[model samples]
Target: MTASLTPLPLQGHVLFRSSDLDEARARVAEVFCPHRLDTSGGGAFAARHHHLAGQGLSLNYIEYGARTRIMPGELGAFYLLQIPLAGGASIRNGAQGYLSTPDRAAILNPHLPTVMEWEEGTRQILVQISRAAMQAHLAAHLGGPSDRPLTFDGPLDLTAGPGAALRRLVLWLVAEADAGQSPVAAPAAGLMAGQIEKTVLSGLLDAAAHDHMAALGRRRAAPRPRHLRLAESYIEAHLDQPITLEDVAEAAGISPRGLQLAFRQHRGTTPLGFWREVRLARAHADLLTAAPGVTVTQVALRWGFTHFGRFSELYRARYGLSPRDTLRAAQGG
Candidate 1:
């Protein structure tokens, strides 16, 4: 069957559509990473890719109307969650191997080598999430950096529990896009897009089996100390202003030294570090909802971030996009 005859998802957002093998490989590579694509069985090739690019991730609908093998060694910068909508695909990510279907999905870790073979008539919805954004989310959960790279134990079960919820969430995003209500497609939808992106990332971490589950559980089980709560409240209130450690310490009714000790013990970071994280988060939100004529400098300055270069670097590390890019996206540029 040719791609034109196939009922495709995200129909209005066509990134690439072609029957030429080389052209298909090159065009798809522009959106994803470089990969080798070849016909594995004696079948005709027809390819279509429909895509929606958002703040920290993208939603894609792809189909190759032939039996094909794809070898993309080490994704390097992003994770891919692929849910087959029509036919199944055999996926091998590093030492793990599985068959992905409608009831079962596959998440490809950025650090692992992957090889996949799609059956003829296979079509799928793929979520590409930035590695930096994912790592930052994980760090927020763990309260510190992970000792090793995060890896999921797949294939993800999409029938019930968190997996089912994740599947629904992804599909909902697609539905919204198709209906012209997607934050991804709307100008000035940054805050909404950021929230959706964060929700999806968080849901993926919760649904999929991963390396940091135990640590995450432990962090959640631990109760927040009274002083820490007070300090956090103070930080939130002062995010738009320049506040020092002494101010937070005083608000929490603890000495600066004691506040530092408590933060290190319970939060796995310094008091200043926690404050910086909160400030960065606020800056992100501001950028996402920024109006036309608002500049990255204005957002950073309003958020108490004085160092422009440093703020941009940290913002990219946390949200996987530069501050200017986020602002431009919010302004519908």
Candidate 2:
């Protein structure tokens, strides 16, 4: 039998297990159904049957048992973080489309119409986090460019990594809540629901960065092999050099202006900015693997940092801590 559990305004959790197709459809339509739903390019997607739930976030899961095509239209209710547990589903957003690998996931903007297709015996998880919830979690990180509704810019591989662990956790939480195993399961589910939302956001950012790089690659006018090789070789060899735009440009045999534009177009960052990030990362790595009594200054200097004051400032800003503090914390001093 299909059962509908109306979620609380800010939180809810539930699980369903049923063989009755009609009942399952009824419950999904009633509980987590989209608000301003419309469809074009008519077709059916699949018969969904699975256990699902969420608290303080709208998480839904289903196991598909058929092949079908979903019409395109805005969900008009909430953003969806769709994770396929088994089998696969394909999605398109007018520009580019991708298929979801098992364990790998995709994010769909509910405000725009999307097309989804699936095969028989498919199982998946869908978490619908509200606009308010997203704004709350992504306060400072939601700057620069707006890149949505164009493609799925999130993790395409879902093995035993953090993404897979999260998928397992969400499944368990929903199942436990549905079974009412513990009286506190509802609240506990709420806490985990927040964590799931954050993970999805982080993965999406990675995918967006990947998409940006791919687009830049396609836009290169002429293959300036010399300039590209010069910039790359200089950055790698002299990462410990007080690398600057002028320095890198000179090595590349190109004007500083040309160098800057090339890095921005191809590498997504200017030469100097990318160099600094590389140095700081190297410093962090040294701190982690350096031998005993390896001071932060030693690590910084090894990575081409001459100004302790400036290096420490940038390190702290990028990594959220001073170098000394990181080494101490790492060694448990």
Candidate 3:
């Protein structure tokens, strides 16, 4: 029996459609890593790829109309989350193996060796996130650099819980792209696009079982220490000025290392992470009630955020909307 399929995603954003196996392999390799693609199953070879690129990630829809085997070895620089829309694929990553279907998705860690056999007629939505971004994000959450590389368990259940929510979020992004309202579209939407990318990365980290889950859970359960409140207040008061970990520690009356430990334990983030959040909140507030002549760039610069793009991204991630959007709403635009 044939599996049901949704309408093709990124229909208006086709990167390529080709019947030549070599051309398909070469083009797809330019986007992802180079891989061995073989279609020796006697099925006709036709491939299509549709893509939407963002600041730190990309969303893609791809299918090879023929049964094909792909050996990409270690993906080295990025992670790939494959959600099958129709039919299925057999995926082997590292020492784990699974049959990925519409109800079950596959997440490939950057360090894992991957070999996949995509069944004929199978179609999938792939989310690609860079390793540097993922590691930096994880470090922010852990409050320090991880001793080991971030790795996720292979099979993800998309029927319920976090996995289900992740699936819905990805589809919603695709829908937004289809409607020409995606944050990934114009350069003006760069900030929003960054937030959306972070959301996807964070969603995947939360949805899949990963190496740092236990530490994350422990941090979440830790009681907020009294010193954190003092540090937070200090950060809030200094939103308009430059500050450092030592300064925050001094204000909190703790050693720098001790303050970092406290922040990690009680706040689940580093002191700088907390400070960034506070600054972002301040920027958000400013945007919400800005004077007619105020601009996003001006507001961001006022909050000690010199990189306008980064400030916008961080602001959107914290406020659930772009700074420009907030300013527009406040201006009754």
The prediction achieving the highest TM-score against the true structure is 1
Worst 10 residues of 1 by lDDT: 1-10
Ranking by TM-score: 1, 3, 2
lDDT-superior candidate, 1 or 2: 1
Against the true structure, what is each candidate's TM-score?
Answer: 0.69, 0.44, 0.68
Instruction: Give the lDDT ranking, best first.
Output: 1, 3, 2
Per-prediction tally of clashes: 0, 5, 0
**C-alpha RMSD by candidate, in order:** 6.0, 14.6, 9.2
Candidate no. 1 TM-score: 0.69
Over 1-333, each residue of candidate 1 has an lDDT whose tens digit, in order, gives 235434456887999889999999999998888999999777789998998988778999998989999998888768999998878999999999999998999999888899999999888999998876787788788765443567898999999999999999999999888887787654557677888899999999999998778767767988778888899898888877888999999999999999988776666667778778777877877887887888999989998889999998777655546889888878888
Could you tell me the TM-score of candidate 2?
0.44
Q: What's model 2's overall lDDT? A: 0.57
Per-residue alpha-carbon lDDT of candidate 2 for residues 1-333, written as tens digits (9 for 90 to 100):
012222311122334444554555565666555222222233443344343334435556565355645553655445566776566778765454788866567667554467777655556667665533343333224211112222345545556655556666555545554665522233555455556557655544444323354533333444545796688788879988776788889989999999987766555556777677667767876785767788988898888888899998876555445788778867877
Mark the regions of model 1 whose C-alpha exceeds 4 Å error after superposition: 1-7, 186-188, 224-333
How far residue 220's Cα lies from its native spot in candidate 2, in Å, is: 29
- Write candidate 3's Cα lDDT for 137-173 as tens digits: 7756654445456889879999999999999999999
Question: What is the Cα-based lDDT of residue 54 in candidate 1?
Answer: 87
